[model samples]
Target chain A: MKNALFVLHNSADTRSSEFATLAAIATSIGNAGYSSDLLILDTTGSSSVNVKHGSAFRNVTAVAPDKAVGDGADYLVHIVGKAASAAVSLVVGFGTISNRNWAPQVAASFSAEFVTACELIEVADNALRVTGPVMGAMVQKTLSLGDRNAVVLYSGENLAAPEGTDIVVEVSREPAEQGAVRFVASEALPDSGGIPLRGASKVISGGLGIGSGEKWRLIEEFAAKVNAAVGASRAAVEMGWVPSSRQVGFSGQKVSPDVYVAVGISGAVHHLAGIGGAKKIVAINKDPEASIFKIADVGIVGDYEQIVAAAMRKL
Target chain B: MDIVVLIKKVPDPNLPEQFVSISDAQDEVVLHASSQYSINLYDLNAVEAAIGLKESAGATVTVVTADDASADQYLRRALAMGADNAIRVELDDKSRRDSFKTAQALVSALKQKSIPSLVIAGRQSSDEDAGYVPYLVAHGLGIPALAPIVSIKSASERTINVGKLADASIDEYELTLPAMLLVSNEINKPRTPGLKGVMAAKKATIEVVASEPGGVAGVPSKYSPKKGQRAIEATKFIEGSDEDKAAALLAALDK
Candidate 1:
């Protein structure tokens, strides 16, 4: 029988989407005839007896963090928690296996520690493969682990379970630890009137082709109308047309939105790298040969000023 | 204060078309003759951060890498960009390094010398895109680490205040000395090597250290395209006037 171990984060809110998704994934693996084992990494050092009984999975088992290492399994799926510190600890815990033959998959927020663990595991064991910072939708569509010995998939925050999947697992606790670095206090900076771009479902970005800082209103108008976050390319940021916080590129935020709209963006490889996880990319550039069009699902070779305005009017 | 920055040499990812698939499994990519290799983009930012610190706070910046002699070229570039010294951790052909192994090698090398008060590295290497070495190094050294940092707000003799960008918000941290910071590209603009700096780099000596064998080497790569993967082709092009194309794009966005 196939054995799959689901390593979930012991979240504070049992009804959180993160927990529900993990439960669904565990249930799906069990239904697939794989003898699934659930190991919830408790960062808060909470008791697991209550958690195991309260979980939706039948015969749920809580594996201690220390003992969780080197648990022989055909598959290891890490459901990333919100706390980067907890995720890092869990990743380091499981990553201690020098040469374990287990396909590990992680779904997380693409934290530095988690990504490093995935890289280290892949480098340490050829048999183990890691895929993700995978989105929840992708996980739902491709949940089958099949016969892989070791797979690592990283699911991000706020994931929903697949259709018809029941999410009935809840555990009460505080949020996991942030990391080794201590947080001093939250400083409120001057408002830039920009939304967080990392996890936004839809993003409307402008590039260097937009020309001037004043011209960014075109992007702002488009974003406002579409109810999407505003993003800028590295060039645009460099040119001072937008804040560096709003830049979406390798040097900036890595985003994987459902719909990424690029206006006058030439689609530099650096820009494309940040958007690799984007589901559907729409490019609007006058240059047909622009690299952005190569990856764009739909291409529109035109002037952004006219096209975007026209598109705004239609919307 | 003494600072050490971790850097890497990676094939210019911008030239993806020039990447040759060597294995039938399509697991490996070799650079074409025309393709050039450069310092990992984020590492360059780390180097810039270190140099900026060195200039502002009076510190010596030493750059380290766990790569072969061929990396000297990039190391020289670091020197030109303002690093005081460079070290190359030599490895045997069979000795492959995952992030842990790489960190182990760097740690071993660092142990042979005076441990720096501050360690800096890119958030992640562009090629591996793992972003693990900094944390692993910090963990191995039993030091504190902060990552995805936007800027070093203030630096004193024993403490440094910095900004960290989370998914939705920016958080601040005041880390003591002897900490590791993995910087993002937003930290600072990396300066290009000027003529004088380039000339100075040519004369700079790169210190070489050999890494012990069996330092956690097994996985061949962090990323491998599944078999039968091809370049994406744009399925539809809204061909018409601006109004028609805009309308089509809007329609597609709705779908």
Candidate 2:
């Protein structure tokens, strides 16, 4: 039977939804005629694995249980490479920072084909079918990894994994090759809380059409009422109304929230590309012909201030 | 210490989607007459980072690219932005799309000269956006790599300090010489070239290098648009009093 290995790193930056999404993909691969396993690398040196066993893998394994090997991407690549060399057909990882740092290197080690930002994966007729965005999200290209081992980075979220029997599996390890990189420190930004953007169930974003930095608070308040993450268009970010971290577009974060509310956003192609995976889009723009309305499931044409104020009072 | 920055010239990202069309060969997307080319956005950040390093630590900043001769104008622009020198590795449009092959080509070009102590690149180019080339190039050079960095905390001759914004925190790292850093847009505001800088760049000569041919090539088996129906025909517009419309929106969310 053809086998695939899903790689996960239990790091502070690794999102929980990534675990679930990979599990979902694993389940899908299983149904598509491939056996799947999970390799969780604990870079943070945590004693207990926080990820649940509900992931749809036949067996899950965690590497470097006793100590942290987190500082260098090379070490993670070494451990992942060791596990990946055991006749695995596919190596999958999330599009998180650590994964992005090392996953492609692992692919390069074996001269494997590396696919980034994968939105679709299927196995049929002995060919591995993969789809991902290219050219600044203008086009989606599908490729056949025919008779070649492949490494893939998945960016989608919250796929359902049917119930399955899962068990723990142990793998052999070796000391990481010494590298010159060292971890210095990590400091959390001052609380700007609602929810993190990547996996939030709902997102409320504002753009230049929102007017000024003062009025940007409306988007934040509305998001708080819905317990949603706050996002911004590149225009809003460029205007100094929102932090670059909160910017959503081709150059910023790619979000797949369940419901996305675009307030005063004119729907630039780059901004729309970031939210293409959102299940439903609601646009609020004063301009009746705003491009945002073209892809929105629901739209309200009026002054955003009045509409947001009304929504606030109702809430 | 010498610092090398990798840059790419990409089709204008702000152009409307209607201008984008699948090539006649169906292997890639091509833009129409209105398309213009500019240096990839994040690479500008990379250039700014290299220039910052050059200013602070007294290092020469060299910008390198892997594209055909059309990229020379963009390379001159990088020169205007304070890059001390520029190099172009010749690769056909088809070879440039294969991340592994493109990286191999870069590796060959870099090996032609004295390898720089540091290399900086954009997190991803605006076009293709595969984001694998830098890491692959790092792998080929057998060096450590860090990416999507938000800021540089400190720099010295032997090592440099950098930070990347995580979900909520900024993760910092210190790396010794012979490392790669992929910059994010938050790193620094790129400076506009002055008239003198532009004049100098116009007269500057760019070095052209030949790429060695041997690495795995990655071409998509098929290429197409992700969505067929971009514009929803029957978008439900909530119409009523402001409060009533708000109520309708809330109800829609409940679905």
Candidate 3:
């Protein structure tokens, strides 16, 4: 049976390694007949997880991770841990773009850390709930691998220390992953700038002022016409169109794409940190005078839907 | 209830200045300031939380460190903030990277004092960022532990509420008493020792027993921000009423 090792990275914000996430993933893999083991790499090796809840943390032993060369487990699912590169076992987050750029680089990291779970539980098929775009993509990728597949479940922001050709999940699937497919990226992908912003052209973006979640489609539609990637302002994200990882500016990704389109995005100083380097900016807003116009190379003064429609026609 | 606040001093990893000369010469980064952020913040929060509990329900606060005479100012500061007393456990600074040795020393010292009802500390000292000591301390004490706790409340004398972060959500668990906790920014804003408390602390003479120095040093490479002209402006926002004005402003911003 293939085995999986889950590592919990220590975060100042988290209480215990979200054992529930581990337990759920463990159950899924176990039902598939692969044994899984959980490893809690206490970055702060001193803290405890209250493993049994209000109980002692005697559960953790000095069981060092198996050496990389000897790692025979099929998949290693690292939830939380910090490693600098894809060569390292999976940390809970994504590594640099260089790692995610290739599936094999990320897959190898997980292969290095796979360990079978000692106390495995049977999980119902219902537990394989797909989360953000990356997670959905990862789950789909792993399922496609069938039995004996090693997998790593990480957040969009966390760096990945993959083990091997193990399945890696991300909301925004890269066009290069030979086997993976994008199921919900056009939707969930924008929640995060799953792909690099600097490499993008004809960029599509939104802001908090977009109002409701339903309004997010406006930016998406504009993007669809221009064949552009979607981007968002902090204000738009605060409204919940996207996740924190997708936020652009000082708080989010730093991108320098060509032909940046800001739809209903008021130019907030905080949003400029990442977008400051964009080559060309186009602003569209119903308000004849939104802050986004200040940075626009081309400003359209009218209803965004009308301008966007007119632009799409030209494309 | 007896509460112990575990604090540590290590090389400030963020400050690039100290790392430069040390890296080239000694090949290791050294601890600079004694009143480091992690330890100080954790220590004060632990002390304050303990004091609040004591005043509210009567828990005793004890501040201990694996530091030496050099930590006088910081220890004094902790005391001034109303830590009942302080203890110093020394260690030989050999690898300086092996804080486990320093933790061993402190744990040994604490075992002699009483198994505290609550143990709290910063997630990790800023210098080492090797957030291991608290867990080891908990392991040594043979009790449940929680790290990176943001909010805390006494569920009972032997139980406390801990707010911890998880990948998807925050986990709020009621921890059994006499457990260890790693304090984070979420736990509570640490209180600064006020001027009045400083005066009173001056009158306090802490007993210092010799052991060894904390044995955790590191190689901190200096980080000089690639030097450039620094701008003093805060944040800028685009504001306009008409499309022309807004467009003009946007053009200016792109520049």
Model 1's DockQ score: 0.38
lDDT of 1: 0.61
Cα deviation of A207, candidate 3, in Å: 17
TM-score of each: 0.72, 0.89, 0.46
Candidate 2 clashes between residue pairs 3 or more apart in a chain or in different chains: none
**Candidate 3, B99-160: lDDT as tens digits:** 45565677778877778888878754534333456655665676655544556654467677
Of 2 and 3, the candidate ranking higher by lDDT? 2
Model 3 agreement with the true structure over A200-281: per-residue lDDT tens digits = 5456777755667887776676566455667777566545565433446543454566667677777654454356556767
lDDT of 2 by residue, A267-308 (tens): 987788788778888998989999899899998988889878
lDDT of 1 by residue, B67-88 (tens): 9987898899999999999999
True-vs-predicted CA distance for residue A206, candidate 1, Å: 3.4
Reference-based lDDT, residue B160, model 2: 89
Q: What would you estimate as the lDDT of candidate 3?
A: 0.46
TM-score of 1: 0.72
Residue B110, candidate 3: C-alpha displacement in angstroms: 0.7
How well does candidate 1 score on lDDT at residue A240?
A: 61
The model with the greatest lDDT is 2
Root-mean-square deviation of candidate 1: 8.4
